[model samples]
Target: MKLVVGLGNPDREYRDTYHNIGFNAVDILAARLDAPAFAYDKKSNAELADVALGGKVLLCKPQTYMNLSGDSVGYLSRYYKIDMRDIIVLYDDIDIAKGVVRARLDGSAGTHNGMRDIVSKLGGTGFARVRIGTGFKPNYMSLADYVLSHFSSGERDLLKAACEAACDFTEKWIKGEDWQELTVTVAR
Candidate 1:
């Protein structure tokens, strides 16, 4: 089984924040797949849906909040008996340029506490991941405050488009498209 985990805070207040782009991307994927709406899974402490993405696919949004996201991801991984390599995590990255999406097999957590927690819980950094760029936090703005800020009306359009492009790349990956031939760049 394939697992895709989206990292973000669960509270309603964080729904549209830049840091919650991971959640937004997951929602877009679910909508595109025409899967049932995500429902809270108490056992997993996450919002979840199982859809057919060329096969069985488990989509999850950990409700444990961002920093402690590993708690939920670890639970689902152990419970489902899924191999670490089959798991794909989606999260925002401030270091990457705005309107870009990157995919990698494995990497360090960088400055993302959520990813750091996941690496700690899972005992390593072997899982696949997609890092959606939210752009660097402006010099005048603190990283935490900027990540929690809501996107502007104009920026919303760009983010929405980015989500779609990211979803397309994910779908292609799922369908066995050659990874080396894949290219997804959204900068509008």
Candidate 2:
């Protein structure tokens, strides 16, 4: 089974924040795939849903908030016996400009605290990941505050379009299409 985890803070207040782009992408993917509704899984502290896509695909959104995301991902990885290679993590990247999406089969966690925690718990960087661009933080604001800030209406539209592209990218990846060959950016 392949596991897909989206990293984000779990709370209504954080739902529309730039940092929640990962959660947004998974939600769009679930709808596009006609996947069943996600249910809270206490064991993993995540919301999960299963869908058939050539094989079983487990979609996950950790409920442990961003910094502690590893708590949920690590537990689920062990419980499901999912290899790091079969796991795909989606999260926001402030380093990329908005409307850009990037994917890698394996990589370092970089500046994302959530990814850092996940990498620490998993003990390796061998996993697929898709990063949604949230754009760089303004120099006047702190990183934490900027990430948690809500997007403007214009930015929201751009992000939604980017999320749709990410879902398409993810679908192709699951169906054995080469990820590098897929388009990774949405026209702005």
Candidate 3:
């Protein structure tokens, strides 16, 4: 079985924040599949849903918040006996442009604290990743404030489109498509 993890904080206030793009993307994907709605799992501390592609795939949205995301991830992964290689994490990337997504088979956490904790807890970086771009941080803004802030009305369209693209990217990925063959970045 493959696991797709969408990293995000859980709460109504965080619903539309740039940091919650992961959750947004996962919700899109789940809807596309008409998969069961996400339900909170006490053991995983995450919202869980299952969809079938090549096999049963678990869609996870970590509810431990962004920084402590590893706690939920580690628990689920261990419980599922999922291999590191079969895990895919989707989250926001500040360094890339808003319409772009960077895919990789393995890598460092970079600047995402959630990813950092995930890598640290998992003890490896062999998992796949789909970094949904949130654009670069402005010189005048603090990273925390920026990520937690809502997008402009104009940017909302871009984000919604990006979320769709991310779902497509994820579906193709879990269906065994070649990573390099997928659209690395899709821009309007």
Tens-digit lDDT string for candidate 3 (101-179): 7778888999999999999989999998888899999989999999998888888888888888888878878988876
Candidate with best lDDT: 2
Ranking of predictions according to TM-score: 2, 3, 1
Model 1: lowest-lDDT 10 consecutive positions: 176-185
Model 2 CA deviation exceeding 4 Å by range: 180-183
Model 3 lDDT vs. the true structure? 0.89
By TM-score, how accurate is candidate 2? 0.96
Model 3 lDDT at residue 60: 95
Per-residue C-alpha lDDT of model 1 across residues 1-188, encoded as one tens digit per residue: 88888888999999889899999999999998988989999998999999987889999999998999999999988998888878888888898877888887778999999999999998898887788888999999999999999888888888888778777767766665656323356868
Report the lDDT of model 2 for residue 84: 90
TM-score of each: 0.94, 0.96, 0.95
Selected candidate, larger TM-score, 1 vs 2: 2
Best by TM-score: 2
The per-prediction CA RMSD against the true structure, in angstroms, equals 1.5, 1.2, 1.3
Model 1, residue 160: distance off in Å is: 1.1
